[model samples]
Target: MILVTGATGQLGTAVIQHLLRKVPASQIAAFVRDDSKAANLLKQGVAIHVGHYDDTDSLDRAMKGIETVLLIAGTDEENRVHQHQNVVDAARKAGIHRIAYTSRALKDPTTLVNRLMEGHVHTEQYIKASGLSYTLFQNILYMEAIPQFVGGEAVFERGIHLAAGQGRVALALRSEMGEAIANALASPSEGNLTYQLTGRESYSFYDVAASLTKLSGKIVTYTPAEPATFIAQLMGRGLPQLLAQRITGFVTDIANGQEDIISPDLEELLGRKPTPLNEGLTLLYKL
Candidate 1:
């Protein structure tokens, strides 16, 4: 049986939805921290097992009779590695053979400025050392979250403002990545494999501006900012200090061309080209 952790989140929900299309609900289980949040999964007839990354006993219970576990990376950047290790240890005790983790698609996961990337690097290493067969889906930036990054309704009024100078980022829809993950879970593998699930094409902030302009027909331009200025502006708008810093770091990473690589593995798995940036933006903005 396949068990998916973080089953209540958006990506997890999408993955489970796709999994249901390919397999019976009886063959899939959801490992959630709050069974209350997984009412939909329960209604869909999925086996719901309550668990948390930090709770070994709960994880052990969740892993009962589960052959494969999709270990969704935790959001707590500071304590996530330790939490993932806890799950790994419990999985070993439960005799689970295979694990699939969702990690970022970076050329060097260690060199990034993002604390989240560091956690992923450590977790990946820990999983590799655990002796269980693994699949790592190094996911790229999700196109669906463009509104959150660029500003949702405000972009129409203020255009796109960021510190991402001219670097390119390959984008994929969150649902598509979920589908790819489900596909990986459905197929068993003998050796550890890592797939960089990125968009077929890459785009820069300039490209984003142009797409918005074309879609809105109202001259949406991109204003580049220094990281310090960007952080200050975000803080001025009432964002938390750590959050402001993290958002700025993402722009800086993109400016340095750290996330520009394109990969075909995602499209190869889906048997279709992933959604393009412009098309996705048009749909998002209702242009």
Candidate 2:
């Protein structure tokens, strides 16, 4: 059986849904904190195991009949390293032959592309030394995050305002990433592998503005501000100073062209071209 951690969250839920389409519900198990939250999956005949990452015993017990585990990255950014380590240890102790991880697509796997990639980087190292065959999906930024970067309605109203200058990202949709991951899990593998999941091409914020203009028939613009100015503006909107600075740091990484690489792995796994930026933007903005 396959056990997927964080099965109630967005990415995990997507993974479970796609997995069910390929494999029987009996072959899939969901690791969730609240069984009630997973009522639908349980009703569909999927076994739900209630467990927390901090609880090693519970995690170990959840692995009883599981042959493979997908260690979906935890949301607790501060404690994720420790929590992920617990899951990895339990998977190793449970004698699972293979494991899969949702990692970030980095320009350099050995270095941090940004602060957010820290936990994934450390976890990847731990998994590699665990003597277990692994599949790491180094996913790029989700297209869904565009609305968050440049507001939803505000993007059309005030256009794009970011410190990320002309840096580009080959952003793919989360659902497609989940589909490719499910495809990988269903297929047999003999050795460890890492797939850099990204869209076919890169697009800058200016391109996003252009796409919006073309799709919505409304003129949009992109304003590339200095990192300090953007942080100050975010703080002026009432965000805390530290939070504002941290947000700026992410944009700063983008400005450095940290996410500009376009790889073929995503299309390879999907057996078709991933969604293009313009189409993704249209669906994202409902334009």
Q: Judging by lDDT against the true structure, name the best candidate.
A: 2
Candidate 2: lDDT over CA atoms?
0.90
- In angstroms, the error of model 2 at 232 is 1.0
Residue ranges of candidate 1 with Cα displaced over 4 Å: none
State the lDDT of candidate 1 residue by residue for 1-287, as single tens digits: 99999999989998999999889999999989888999999999899999789888899898999999999988778898999999888888889989889988876655676656678888899999999989999998899888988888788789888998888899889999999889878876768999999999999878888888888788878889899999999999999999999888877888877788788889987889988988899888788
lDDT, model 1, position 220? 76
Residue-level lDDT of model 2, residues 13-99, one tens digit each, is 999999999999999999999998999999999999998999998998999988889999998988998899999899999999789
- Cα TM-score per model: 0.97, 0.97
Model 1 alpha-carbon miss at residue 39, Å? 1.2
For candidate 1, the clash count comes to 0
- What TM-score does structure 1 among the candidates reach? 0.97
Q: What TM-score, to 2 decimals, does candidate 2 have?
A: 0.97
